[model samples]
Target: MAKGLLCSAMQMTWRWFSPDRTVTPRRQLRFPAYTPNAVSLALKSISKKTKCLPFGLRQPDRPLLLGGHSLDIVHCHQYLGVWFDSRLTFATHVHYIRERAATRIAALKALSHSNLGALYSVLQTFYSYAIHSIVDYRAVCLVEVLESLRLSLEVLQNTVLRVMLGAPPWMRLVNLRAESGFPSLQHRIWERTTAVIAQLCRHWPRFTVSVLLQRTLDRPPNPHPGGDWILLAADIVRKLDATNAICGGPDLPDPAYAPAPPWLPPLIRCVEPTTAVPRSSFPAVLCQDSLSHVAALSTPDAAVYYTDGSVSDDGSAGAAFVCDEWVESWRVTSSVSDYQTELVAILGTLRHADRHFYRCIIIHTDSLSSVCGLQTQRYTDNKYLTAIIAVAASITGQGGEVILHWLPGHVGIAGNERAEADARHAATFPVPTFQLHPSLSLLLRRVAYTVRHLSWEDHQFQIYEGSRSATWYAIETAYAPVTVPHGTSNYLLVSLRHLRLGFPCCGQMTNSNPEPCPHCFDISEQPLLHYVLDCPATSRLRCGISEQLHNRDEPFIWQQRLLHRHLPL
Candidate 1:
């Protein structure tokens, strides 16, 4: 299963690899260009940079247009125009065009007519429309010049909207004759669009087109029936074209897939449609390349880090253990913040626990909430907490044990100090514009990609280990019960009885409301069985530990028996 997964990932990744670019499972090499999916992935990842910036423009470092031949470029240009025209429904086009005109008028009337800002704004709008039309719509050719003209409103709107809505206020008013004269300029723009529509009506065979368009531009009704009218027009067009095709006349293909240029190189001819439906069996590109998911698994052991969440008077806090480095990292944020915020960052790191060096798992944190939350059988309440729990399950499902420990915040521990600095820096810094470590970024991409394709049930289980040097298990045993020696512990014990006496057991009301157990049950005053056989939290904690041990094919019943025997019976 591991090998299959790794292979599938590599294959899918390689499909984006052009003839000149290749990825080897064994060695590191950079591809000159990114795949469409890679670009999409990059766009999605931009959220990690900062929330302030708009994510749409977060493009790949290299341009997608690079490396294609002139013919490929020409075809691409044509395809783009068709795509844009087809993708925007008629009503969308009308709405967008109308909106564009309004914005354009607003920008033009913001300042005096002859100002540099006015001229620049107008020219930029036209330039953007022209370029976008050519590159995306391939609408430059004049076989049906009227069709391109039909798209004029959409083009104009896109340009003006960006300038008017997206730019600074000063810039928006750059060409305005006077601030108060703005409404007049907008009125003039409406007149201009109306005149254009008049021209289309004069030449076009379709009278309904004019009426429908006038409905959009003239503001026919309160709800703006332009969109529905435009859809009606499109339906008419499609029906007319279908009738023509049935009559053995020139068969007009549906407009959605934009027809390619009538004249192109023979090589650019459309391939025959596939006879069989395309199955998503491992992409062929993935099968051809070799990548081993298990290879990384076999590499010299790396230390596992376990971080837990906490809340205190000072702020939200977290503790982490770096197994290989034998360091504990912990932090305390301002108490006002939510626990889940800190948990996201910590859980993100823990999910990738095997990436670091050393064979040990060291936990450093004062977050009893996080530790208890993971150990307990209660359903997580917070959305972020639930996500973290799912990820923890995925990690431990692979026979890995996360050793959670508590550390006093502000006590000046080195790892905790570093973590605090990192956390504070993360809070203050804007989302990164770009990741410095591309390799790590790529690894993250692979994991994310895998997650998307694989269901939660089929997710890979990664085993977590502690430090490799100097009898790490032996060192761990010093702090653990004697039944488990020089190995990962197989039982979880907590002071839950004092925390909630009957909350996990009876679900009964009490005279005084104690703080509810963060792990289990909803009520604060309910008595809980924290001692031996009955406590839900304890039972859950025991089950989780036993499952981990059983996954490793180790005898955990003995450990459970020991814990049961040790309980105050």
Candidate 2:
């Protein structure tokens, strides 16, 4: 009866809003269970299973009237590309994703041919943007779904990885992921979900989703059998140990007002080195000359201030501004990035200028990022930057002029040197807090650190469990620091990866029938090693390559040679 009244009210509301438009009953879905009585006409084509009643309750057969039309109920529906069912199991969605991913995986397979298809790197890029994007979309909402659903997604990822690498089904999943540098689907989902939760925590007041999340978290714990996304997110955060890293508090106001328009007279001036200034000039001399040039260019009455920001080895951040009349320094949260600290220094200078009603203010900073950010209006994304722009706009509105001068750092300009020292001191010894909220960059860094730590732990466990061979582990450890140089051919990368994994290209590692080396019929066992190092067929090439090595006297280890590690002198 309640559902009937709700339908009637919706019908009346729809007609009142749009008289010409009619409600489409066929598109609607009813949760938990559907009933035949809900429909006006007896539609024989409608399945009886869809209308199965809950708790064995039955009512007199009646039609659900909507805008003077009968409405039909559905057991499942698709909204925004995600399938939803009465039970909210997400099984339908997972199945759909697997089918969709299989289609793309087939396309990838078509491009995996050795000579006729696209490069491995190209295929990987396509997977990241095309296939992975589909699977990762709205994955945060699926955090609490059944383990089977999660495993299905994992299986989909594993299949894609196998197709991309052309790895045999016998290859272990851990080795496959390590070789490809792709984390497990579950880890990826957790990372993505944690990132979203961090963002929501930071901007809780700004977005509707954040507001809803905040409300949900504020209420008493109400356990749901299927589990709750918000609770799962909170648990993930706790596990990451990033509760303190979660940024909270309102964002700064937009600084796009007329007084601070992007077209406003050149406020930020970068000091470009000229041809007259020889590159071989002493650092101190160069800084002195630059300072003199800036002073000459500035207004005679303008108050010149030097601002600098610093980050200690321990990650504490500090910012300071030094002027003739007064000097101020602040110790910001360690999570605040060096770039943000630089902006904070500039912001302090602006606030000081505004407070003292300086007619002309010139702020000299060595941070080009901060200067560029101001010029490009990138301050909209950061609180300190936004505050800087706001204060600068206020100064400009009151018939005052503000200018920023970019100069080289650690070059010994007196005021800049003093500011730098004060910033260092502030960073070393905690001063008053400037801002407590962590910078977005720092939050992202923390999240990446947590994800990497977790991944490393998992990798170690895999190694301890004997999932990877010692030779494979040694190769991975050696090549961990090494990266493929730019412009490397796709064929070379694939060959190198195969070499690292000890893939049975030579058939010696195969369990069944092993084949002898084509070049050397005598060398049947360990054909890969013999082909690379012992084969007389490639002896001339090997000798030629050996002469180019730093130490030709030392024998080239297979691990070093195959992984392409630089030979020690």
Candidate 1: where is the Cα deviation over 4 Å? 1-338, 354-360, 432-569
Encode model 1's per-residue lDDT on 402-500: one tens digit a residue: 444443344444454565555544443333321111111222233333333322111111102221211222222211222322222112122211111
Candidate 2 residue 480 Cα shift, in angstroms, is 2.8
- Model 2 regions more than 4 Å off: 1-63, 206-226, 247-296, 324-326, 376-380, 410-415, 474-488, 504-569
Worst 10-residue lDDT window for candidate 1 reads 1-10
lDDT of 2 by residue, 157-188 (tens): 88888888877786667666766777888878
Best by TM-score: 2
Instruction: Score candidate 1 by lDDT.
Output: 0.33
Q: Which candidate tops lDDT?
A: 2
TM-score, every prediction: 0.20, 0.75
